[model samples]
Target chain A: MKSLLSVQSHVAHGYVGGRAATFPLQYLGWDVDNINTVNFSNHTGYGHFQGSAIPEPELIKLFQGLNQIGCSYDVVVLGYIPSAELIDVVASEVAALKKSNPSTRYVCDTVMGDQGHLYVNNSCVDAYRKLLSTKIADVITPNQFELELLYGKPIDSEKLLRDAIAYMHDTYGVDHVVISSLDASVLNLQELQLICCAVSSRFKERSQEQSQLQVFLVPEIKSYFTGVGDLFTALLADKLFTNNGNLVLAVNQVLTIMSNVLKLTHQLGIKEFTQHYGEDSCERLAEGRMNDGESMRFFELRIIQAREFYDYSGAGEFSAIEISN
Target chain B: MHRNLLSILSHVCHGYVGNRACVFPLQCCGWDVDTVHTTNYLNHPGHGTFQGEKNDGRTISTIIEGLKKLFDLREYYNVVLVGYCPSAEVMTAVYEELEPIYKTKDRKEGPVFVVDPVLGDNGRLYVPEEVVQVHIDFLKRGLVDLTTPNQFEMELLTDTKFLSWNDVKSACYKFYDTYKVPDFVILSVLIDEQMYSVGFSASTETVFYVPIQEIRCRFSGCGDIFTALLTNEFYSNGRVLSPQVLTLVVDKLHRILLTSFREERARLGRDPDVIHDINLVRLRDLFERSFGGDLEVKYL
Candidate 1:
């Protein structure tokens, strides 16, 4: 059986980070070795949570013990490093493991911030840039803001986005880069749009020569959802590993699953609001009047409720097309 | 409506044991499980040298406190399942933190507390003796709504050693009589070369047995898996520990164990007797074969 090492944050209450990633991988039949960078009372989305981050020393000790076990994993999915120091530790560890088995895939989700807001310390961005420079990760999943950050410039137009993708490929030597979520309003698309991008190369005899970008445009869901990125990275890794690094198929499969999950999340969120504030308040809830406390129950990605959808047959109801430059 | 389960148990990164063994199957059966780890280890201790640390009682208390803050406990969970509390301190902390939810009678109905009294098996104790005492005290206080104890735990709880099937049966009855535990199942007893699992319900005051075909595989986490199957079956069957439930539980357990045993043997290219560990990943695949269908019980 294939195996994955999932290193991320852990929440005791709700799913995020490791909690969000491990289950779907397990359901897809991967033996997962999980190391939590932080153990929190719940996801920070709760506004109030308790618990502490696992110190760098303890994390290193745990990894060393696993190394002693002499088990190699097919993939390693990293997310939500709480500290820059921890990121350095993870980078060294991934470097050593990849050196031992060059075929092992590293799926890195540069989880720094969302919607133009940075959550971690500023040093973390530098650490991520340093790690990406090593080109240790096989696949990188970054949203628009993270893409802009990594590019070291604001991506305000399609030209800049395309340039950023090419720069990342040429500079970082990353085999595949998936921009999971990009605001479509930047492109002046017809109704509030979300653009997902996947860039991969058709290596001619082990040399990086030809590359193509597949763009997926879909109407964005109206509600803000936590754990979507974590879930997306996990599903993307699964599809990529199973599909033999087919970037287009992986992006399509992940978006297909995400669409179902987010759609259910929005419906559940709306139903929770309508039940409490009457049916007339639906528009108000959509207008973003909902607080974290009021929408906590609904905003949760209905992963468990939509468990069967994970086994979805071959990328349902979503497709991506190659973008010509 | 969906059922929610809160499972507090040991977490091993390598193999499925304790909550690792229980959570996936329960989720496969369509319950949303919230897990709190009592200890974190690289693998089950049976694999010999392992790393990781035990979560102190305070950590368990903090997580439970967080749960209380985030959820209206009465309406949030349908089942609270406790397994493999490593130390007496952690066990006591969990019981105290959960006591109100288990003890409270107001605001609709409270969640059912299912305890798998995980002291030890095969006449040996894995945890410190204090933890065993804590489980007995908790049982005596009538805190556990349902419990599945092995023959040794039943013997310890009743202060009786099993000399025969009747002796084990009397001990279970005495435990029910003394503590008035709503439901109890005595698992893994060998009587006259035949393996049997005995169950008793205080509501009925009757005892029943489900015979198990002895497989050579002695894998860890069988008790944990048994308790989870019991919890799922009994909860869905209107909270009855009837013979039917026992038969269903044993049937599923038998198939899983048999398949795991055979698969491990085949993978090792050896006899089943030489296989020491069950492949949980394989077991999960076998279980998912009949995921949504009604589990058939041919023994009944």
Candidate 2:
């Protein structure tokens, strides 16, 4: 069985961070070991949550214990560290793991924020930049905002986006870079169409001069959902590893599964809202008038219900469009 | 509709035990699990060298309070499952937080409380002595609806020295009568080289024994996994302790253990005594499948 170490946030009451990532990876047949960066009552999008961030020392102690037990993994997936110090710890620990076993793959999800909002500490961007410069991560799944943050500039144009992707490949030495989701406005696409892009530098080792880039256009679900990014990163990591570094197949497979999960979540969320507060409440929800607690309820991912799709081997609804640079 | 469960247990980074063993299976069975970790260890200690720290009572209280503050425990959770409290203080914190919910309503209206009194096994005590006392005190308060204890813990709970099956029955009766706990299941009892899970319900006045197939190898998280499966089955069966639930839990556990045993043998070659980590991820199909087994439950 494949083993992975998952470093992320853990919400006791909801599926985000490790809670979202761990089960799907496990169902995909990976033994996942999780180190929770923060233990929260629920995701922060709820507007009111209670829990404490795990101190840096505690994080070190957990990693030290793993080291003492001689625990290594086939993959190490990093997501949602709250501060720069914690990210530093994760970087060092992952670096050590890679140094010890040169074959260990690292999947880094630069989880700073989404849609121009930064939820984590600002220093985390610099921390991630430093970490990526070390050339330790094998694959990185970042959103448009995070990609721009790592590139240290705004990627408002297609040219800038390609430059950023190339910079990540050439400078950070990352073999696989997947822009998990690009804002429709960034690419001037239809609002209903979500763009996902994957780039692979693994072909370079075969003496191929150019890297392969694949872009996927998938229909968007209008409803808001949390944990989508975490789940996507996890599935992408597993599929990339299982499919033997096939970026297009991995991204296509992940997007297909994610589309199914979001649709289920939306359907269930509507059913629950109508049952609780009648049909009119959904209009209020769509208008963004619901209170934070009620609004958060509508966004909880239907992870358990959508378990069957985790191992989807069938053809995906969306196919990648190869783009040459 | 899926039921909600509050699982208080240990969290390990490496292997399946405590919440790691319980959460995935319960979630796969269509339950939403909210966990409060009492300890965080790198792996199960059976590996001989482990690293982690035991959480204090304050941490437990803080998390539980956070849950209670945000959501109504009575409405949100259908079951409260407790396992593997590392310290007596942590156990006390759990009891203190949960006692109020039990105090407000009876078991029928409130969440069902299931405690796997994880003290020790094989005639030993792995936890501190104070932990045992706290468990006894919690039981005496009539707070738990059901508890699954092994033969060794059953002995400690009832303060009995069992030489025969009758002694075990009497201890069960003592537990029901004295603690007012409605149901109890002795996880494993070895009688005549055969293992059986003996379940008793005070409400139904029923006693049944579900035989467990003896796998040659030992495992670290079997008991934890068994308790999780039992909790899921028990709720699915309308909160009844019957021969059917026991049979399903034992059968599923049997398949998982047997698979783990076979895999270990294949990997390590016939090392019968080595304790193996049951790969629940590999057994995902087994968990998702509807529970079925041909094992017969013998009524006592």
Candidate 3:
């Protein structure tokens, strides 16, 4: 069995961070060791969350414990580090793991914020820049905002986005770069259609002229959901490893599973909302104007219910569109 | 529908003990588990060299308080499982935070509190005496609906010596009458080369025993896994304990242990007398399989 070290936030009530990531990986046959960066009551998207980020010293001590036990992992996945200092600690620990094994794959989700909002400290951007400069991360799944942050510029057009992917590959030696979500305006696409792009360095090495990019179009669900990014990164990591570094195949499978999960979550959320506040509440839910804590409960990802979709390898409903620059 | 569970336990980074052993199995069985870790160790101490520290009681209280802010614990979770608190302060903090939910809950409706009083094994106390005292107080207050204790902890809880089945039966009754806990399971009872898990159900007013196959290798996380599976089965069977549930749980556990033993032996090319971390991921299917042919259950 493959072993993975998952470093992320942990909420006691819902699926996010490590809670969202650990189960799917374990179900897909990986031994996951979790290091919770924070222990919150629920996700911060709820607007009223209780809990604090785990102190840096405590985080360091957990790593030291893993080292003392001679624990080594085949993959290390990083998510939701609250501070720049913690990010530095993670970078150093992951560097050490790579140095020791020389084959340990690092999957990093640069979880600063989504849709132009920054939840973590701004300094974390610099920390991530420094970490990526080391080229320790073998795979990175960054949303459009995080990709722009790390590339040190705006990716407002498809051409700019392609340049940014190429920059990540050339500068950081990143083996795989997956743009988890793109702004619809960047590609001038339909409002309800979301795009995901992936590029693999192996493909770039195979062809000298231009890198091959795979784009997947996904339908946007009307309700707000948390932990989608965390879950996507986790499933991608498992699939990438299992599919032997085939980025197109892995991302295709991951998106299929994600689409299925989102569809189920939206259906369940609507059912729950109607049950609580009558059928009229469906409009309020679709508008993303859930005001109270009770409504927030309905938005949690139906992760456990969607377990069967994790190993789904059927013909991809969202097949990748091959793009060459 | 997926059932929700709150698991307060230890977390080891490398091994399957406490939450490490409990969470995956429970999740695979369709439980949404939220965990508050008591200690974060490198691995279980069975490895002889361990690292990590026990979390502060204040941290435990704070996390629980955070959960309470977002959820009505009574309504959110179907089961609350507590196991392996390393310190008395931590244990007390758990009780103080959870007592309110227990107080307001209707016992027959839902949200059963299952405590595995993990003090020690085989006539020894690994934890400090204060921690043991805290567990005693928690049980005596009737804060727990059900508890799974090993033979040694059962002795400590009831202050009785289990020389035979009769002694075990009396202790079970004593526990129920004194603590007001309706159900109890004494894990890993060995008599004349046969292993059994003896249990008492208040609703049924009966004492019964389920035979367990003895794997030669000693495993660290068996008790934690047992408690997790027991809680799952107990909740699934309408919050009640029966011979059928016990038999199914024991049978599943036996298969897992046997698989772990055989795998460890094959890997080492020798007899593995003590297995540190059992392979739950490789044995994932065992947790999902439906076991038929209930073991011969005998009444005391």
Candidate 4:
């Protein structure tokens, strides 16, 4: 069986970070070792949370202790590192892991900021860039804003996005780059879809005019949810490890599971909204200004409640568009 | 009311034990489980050595207090499961901290506190003797509605040496009669080659004995798993009908243990990395058994 070392934040009340990702990977038959960075009462999107962050020295001690115990993993997934110092420590550890076992896969979720806002410290961007410069990570999943943050420019168009991917490949030597979300205006499509693009460092030589990007599109669910990215990164990394770097198949597998989860989440959220307020209160709430807290309470990813969807292997009607640019 | 549960136990990062062994099974049973970690470690200490700190009374009480402030403990959970209180300080803190909340709750609608007094196994105590004393004192206070202890813990609690079924039954009755705990289960009563568990419900004024074939395997967290299964089954079955609940829980645990052994054998066959004599599962199949409910049980 494969083993995964998941370094992320933990919440006692709700699912996010390690709490969100660990179960699905375990259900997929991987032995999971979870290192919690913060033991919070709940996720922070609720606007009220209480807990303490694990200090950097303690984190180092824990990792070193694992090493002393001869605990090695096939994959090390990094998510929600709370401090730049801890990020540095993680990078060094990942490098050491790769040096010891060249077959070990390193996946960096690059969880800095998303949707035109930076939720973590601005120093995290530098930390991520420094980690990427190590060239030890095999897979990096970053949203559009995070992609632009890495390249230090706005990827406002298809041309710029492709340039950024190529730059990451050329400069950082990372193999697979996954943009988990893209602005709909880039494609000029109606009925907005949550599209993810998977690009490989080994691009086709005949694709000077044809894009080598595999685009996976799923219909968007209109509710605020957290931990979607964490779940996506986990599934993507598991698929990549199992399939031996087949980006297309990995992306399709993740999308199938995610789409089902989101659809169920949205339905449950609407049901909760109607239950709490009245029949059609979800419509009333949807027709007005969106409240993130209220919407999130109704949504909350439904990760634990709708856990059966994690085993979905079919992509359904969703298929990848192999763009040639 | 909703089937919500609050579990206070140990959380291990690597292997399943304590809440790691308890929480997932309850969740799979469709209960909303909220957990407070008494301590967090890399793996069970039975693995030779482990890392992480013992979450002290202050830290634990703070987390529980935080939960109360946010969710109003009495309103949020219908079942409170306690296990492995590592220290007398922590045990006292847990009781004093939650006493007010339970007191405020309407008794008819309040949470049912089920204590698994985890002191020691195999004729010894793992934690300090004061921890055992604290547990006895807590039970003496009649705060817990249910308590599950193995033979050694039961012996320690009642301070009795039982050589037969009648002695063990009298010890259980004496415990309930003294502590006023409405329900008590003595997990593992050994007679000759067979092992039996005694479940007694004072409310129904009944007792039941469940015996299983003694499989020679050493695995951590069986006690924790059995406690979780008992808590959920008792709660869902309306806390009465002790015989039926105990039978179901024991049968499920036996089946899961068999599955774990089979899985371990299969794992050793495929993976050359695993050395023999290591418990491959170490309580890893809570989720696997969550969806498993088809085990046929013929109660003897």
Clashing pairs in 1: none
Candidate 1, residue B136: CA error in Å? Answer: 2.0
Q: Of the true contacts between chains A and B, what fraction does model 4 have?
A: 0.30
C-alpha local distance difference test of each model: 0.79, 0.84, 0.85, 0.75
What's the DockQ for every one of the candidates?
0.56, 0.72, 0.73, 0.41
Worst 10-residue stretch by lDDT in candidate 4 chain A? Answer: A202-211
lDDT of 1 by residue, A280-313 (tens): 8778766776546656755777667777778665
lDDT per residue, candidate 2, A29-105, as tens digits?
89999999988878876677877888888899888778778888999999999999999998897777788788888
Instruction: Say which candidate scores most in DockQ.
Output: 3
Candidates ranked by lDDT, best first?
3, 2, 1, 4
* Model 2 CA RMSD to the hidden true structure, in angstroms: 1.9
Residue pairs with colliding backbones in model 2 are none
Q: Which tens-of-lDDT digit does each residue in B2-116 have in candidate 2?
A: 6889999999888888999998888778788888898877788888887777878888888888778667798778999999999898999989999888886666888989999
For model 4, residues A242-323, the per-residue Cα lDDT tens digits are 7777887778778888878888877876787788778867667667534444555566676666667766655435677766
**Could you tell me the TM-score of candidate 1?**
0.94
- Ten-residue region with minimum lDDT total, candidate 3 chain A: A200-209
- Most accurate candidate by lDDT: 3
Comparing only chain B with the true structure, the TM-scores of all models are 0.92, 0.97, 0.97, 0.88
